[model samples]
Target chain A: MANTGSNQVPTADVASVASSPRPYLPGDLAMWFFILAELTVFAIFIIGFAVTRQLYPDMFQQGQTYLHPVAGGINTIALISSSCLVALSLNAIKHSRQNYAAALLGGALLTASVYLAVKSWEYNELIQQGFGLSTNTYFTLYFFITAFHFMHVILGMIILGSMAFKTTKGAYQGKSLSGFESGACYWHMVDLVWIIIFPLLYVIN
Target chain B: MKPFGKMEYCWWTLIGITLFNTFLGEQFSSSALVSILVALTVMFKGLMIIDHFMELRHAHRYLRLMMRAYLIFFPSLIIVTTFL
Candidate 1:
């Protein structure tokens, strides 16, 4: 590996900082905008949930009786763990620790799997109990919001998987890390959404 | 205290809060005070993610504040709508 400078910071990184000056934003500017847009859409949906719950407080209360708080708790831990791993993975990659970063990405994927598994278990249980989206207003919103988030989780895993592949090949070493940072940042957005959703759906009830 | 030598400390705090929220959820049904507390917790968790996990504390002022708006807005909305 070519040594860029005494700070051990790569030339690309030094260039990034010099170009931006102090108070660096860590990922692609476009990615940040994308995250904001996504957040807006979800905000609308959650507000809908709140309004509908207000309209039919009894129905929502009935719905909450079936939710498993323990499962939600486990899923929260899983997603937060995955987010931390992704952040640490980016930190490792920034330092050019490619293999370690790749491993961290793998760990992130594994933890994310825990979230999916717990969610799937919840969905299956809800379905087996004869609850469907059409069951009532509450179930409909529940399925819609969570299914949308579930799809995002799958997409995030794909992005992380691609990053892990490229990391193992040293694609980001001594090079611009914008692509990797963008992907990592996206994964964190998923966790961010869940951080609210868990309480909104399961805990608030 | 090099409290944040790594992401370790933030991660642990998040885990603790998740468990706490779970406890709150199970221990009490939906009430005004509980709802407000839960919404506040959402804001706290949002700040933790934005500052630490997303590394936005050292970020540009405008961009960081944009993210902050989302994290803060929704929870506040939840609080307001709770009273509605």
Candidate 2:
């Protein structure tokens, strides 16, 4: 169906799909399904968090003041950086650099690890002050929402970690980078969710 | 394979905008305007990741449409529930 005929017959389909900016998507289609489904769940949770915050504005405001915005902000930057590394890893694999892609994935994993460490510190402080999940409306939503995203970050890291191992194993050569793309897509979703969470819970007091 | 592609550029932009948003939110803590600005910043950052880092800029028409729809839908939820 591709009449342009790039002359590279073996990779013609992929090249055609890549060249056409429409009617085709990147990576495995099933992964997109999962990404959309996960996003829908988080969207509902976020809206719920907002409605509850509206109901108890004073509680949310007070909770926000007690929490450390700097930690959240730093985690935001860390996740953003990790997502960037994931994107770079995808690019590296696209250019047929398996080792380079693995290295980039390792970097992404390290950045995410840092985010979790800082988050654990924040959780420790909150728990020390007796702000458990049952503390109040504000702390309840805060812990639940952030914890949900926190788990996703760990899952993203696991996916990235496996991708790194496979890349190092030479599983994804020039045209077989779908696995890496799928992992990167999920990582970016984690980052996107936190982008909203940061402003809503931490900044918008 | 450029050393610094558009994705890197988009990442840097996300960082700068996020820091600016934090500064504005802190500076205008009492003003009603900061919430709107924060919502907008959140939306913008989501869009940047969807379109650039996720490489959906060249995705299928419906996929691109749906992702952008969520970007607007979710962030607008935040803004709406905040003010109304």
Candidate 3:
């Protein structure tokens, strides 16, 4: 309710505006649907990982031995850091802080790159040790799940890169932020999935 | 700390939770209790992400419900399958 001079502005006039709930679902409708679809795929892979581990405890246990839990922890921190950057960047955009948002998004991209580097190094080490997809059921599912997620991280990095570029141009300043929100949401999904993946794969054992 | 908004607080708590969960998980390993704890931790983290990070707290009811369901169901499924 904008203040008026006399201060007796009719209550009925602004009642709806003041009373109505702003149930804002951030991001594009299409993006939410896409998030749901992507989550469904990841869910299936994760469930498969669980079910297969049940069937082959020994294999899964051995596979866990070959994994680098320390690396997993590092990647977890990296992803979480990136997610935080994405969220903070969007918040910056909301405040019309373009350069700050761009810097944060760039930080996000860099953190995600850290995750990619660690993951790729882990993959290389595993391959050098003869742990390919065909190695066993455990390695098969391991490669299947992690590789799928790895690709998503790469895609997320691309999205963040683009978002950072646009942020620098002041494109989102004082504008409808659905696009900015969507990219941030996607990066967060990648992070959310990792929050589950790291504990399940490396910590829970 | 003085100027932090809700999102900043959420971010800080999330970092704390992640590190804490990692520590607890390592300490307990694969015990039945730790397994269940892991499941619950995942749920908590998912809720924080979907509701807070994703800002779905004020979104339509079903969207939050659906995402919540996914986070809950999978961890529960893992717990069930672990004993099978």
TM per candidate comes to: 0.91, 0.91, 0.88
Which model scores highest in lDDT? 1
| Global lDDT of each candidate | 0.84, 0.80, 0.78
Interface RMSD in angstroms for candidate 2: 1.8
lDDT of 2 by residue, A18-93 (tens): 6764455556678889999988888888888888877888888888887777788889999999999988887677
Instruction: For model 2 chain A, give the 10-residue run with minimal summed lDDT.
Output: A1-10
- Candidate 2 per-residue lDDT over residues B1-84, each given as its tens digit: 567557778888899988887676566573457777777888889899988788777677788999899888877876676557
Per-residue lDDT tens digits for candidate 1, residues A1-205, read: 2211222344333235545555576667788788889988888898899889889988998999999999999999999999999988877776667899899999999999998999999999999999999999999999999999999999999999999999999988777677787898899999999988999899885
Instruction: Supply DockQ values for each candidate.
Output: 0.64, 0.67, 0.52
Give TM-scores of chain A for all candidates.
Answer: 0.90, 0.90, 0.89
Comparing only chain B with the true structure, the TM-scores of all models are 0.87, 0.81, 0.78
The iRMS of the candidates, in order, is: 2.9, 1.8, 3.2
Please give the lDDT score for candidate 3: 0.78
Best DockQ among the predictions, by candidate number: 2
